[model samples]
Target: MEQVAEKLGRPDAGDAAMGKAWGIWYGSDSTAKRRDEIAIYSSYRDTSMRVKDVKQIRITSNAFKTQDGLATGANLEDTKLKFPDIKKLSSYLNEKKDTVVVYDAKKEGIGFEFLKGKSISLTVHPVNTAVNDTYLTLHPEWKLIN
Candidate 1:
């Protein structure tokens, strides 16, 4: 925990929820106009807790991009062009009437959520993680893209 704080110049805040601990680093001027807040998640179980591995990374910044140049503000068409292997999963229309498209790059162990055809967030985690489980449960009409 100290190493991460030291490397990232100390987290602005942190929290614990859903069996995980999160250290959030708000962007600063030194970080090229850090407009996106970066969050790092670690496991918290019982009295034994350690930052052995990053459980997940939730990115909302446009500053960071995938190796293939995918980032928050990108459109679905460009995403498809950039990542031919990207799979289009089920989608849900939120209360705002914008369609939220869920995509999985299984090979890359990442999932992307797009709002109204524009990328909004990118989540890094295990490919088999149930990121869409709740959605599936709520919207059985939407089929998994396989």
Candidate 2:
């Protein structure tokens, strides 16, 4: 945590808790706001939580791009062009009650979250592991997207 604070400057403490994961957020002040927010997650209160290793990094800005130029705000067609093997993984309603679609390129270890056909965020995970194999929060009511 100190190392991240050193490299990225200070981060705002995330107020919400999701299961056993704790989020540390950056760019959330009035100057940057939520649009430029980046969230880093760490295991919380579990036996393994003591390590505090980064479990997830959530990017909500287009300023950061993948080597192939994928970023937030990209449409499904554009994302498909960059990741031809990407497939609809699942769908869930966010806290806002808006439906979000998750697309995964399993071999690439990257997934894109789309809301209304536009990419809203991207998730990185271990290559070769399905999204279902990760620590991502799951909704019992999740809908499988074809």
Candidate 3:
């Protein structure tokens, strides 16, 4: 936690996983059209309760892009061009009650959440780790998209 705070400056620790985990948020604001947020999740197993061994990172802004120029707000078809192996995973209602479709490139350790056919967020995890294997909490009522 200390190392990350030093390297990335300070982060706003937000409640997540029903207070079982902390989600360190960067550039997260309520009013911005593009929040440019990056949330890092730490292991719940860590006894220290600090951000030791970050587990997942979620990017919710278009400011960050893949090497191939894919970013949030990108078209699903466009993203498929850059990640041909990506496949539809599921669909869930976001905070705004908008239907968000999730897709994953399992081997690449990257996933995308699409709203209205446009990417709205991206998640990065350990290479080869399936999305289902991560600690991320998904809405239980979500429907399988593929």
lDDT of 1 by residue, 1-146 (tens): 56666788867777765555677777765755335677776664345554344666767788888887778888878877876667877677655555778887766667778876788778676666644432213233544443
The per-candidate count of clashes, in order, stands at 0, 0, 0
For candidate 2, write residues 39-116 as lDDT tens digits: 665555466645556655667788889998889999999998888999887788766677998888889888888998
Cα lDDT of model 3 by residue, 1-146, tens digit: 55666877767655556324445555746788755777776664456664457767788877888888888989988988988999887777755667888889989989898888889888887878766577556344555444
- TM-scores of the candidates are 0.63, 0.72, 0.76
User: Which of candidates 2 and 3 reaches a greater lDDT?
Assistant: 3
- In angstroms, the error of model 1 at 46 is 10
Off by over 4 Å in 3: 16-20, 26-31, 44-51, 138-146
Per-residue lDDT of 87 in model 2:
87
lDDT of each: 0.67, 0.70, 0.74
* Candidate order, TM-score descending: 3, 2, 1
Ranking, lDDT, top scorer first: 3, 2, 1
Question: Which model, 2 or 3, shows the larger TM-score?
Answer: 3
In angstroms, the error of model 1 at 87 is 4.5
**TM-score, prediction 2:** 0.72
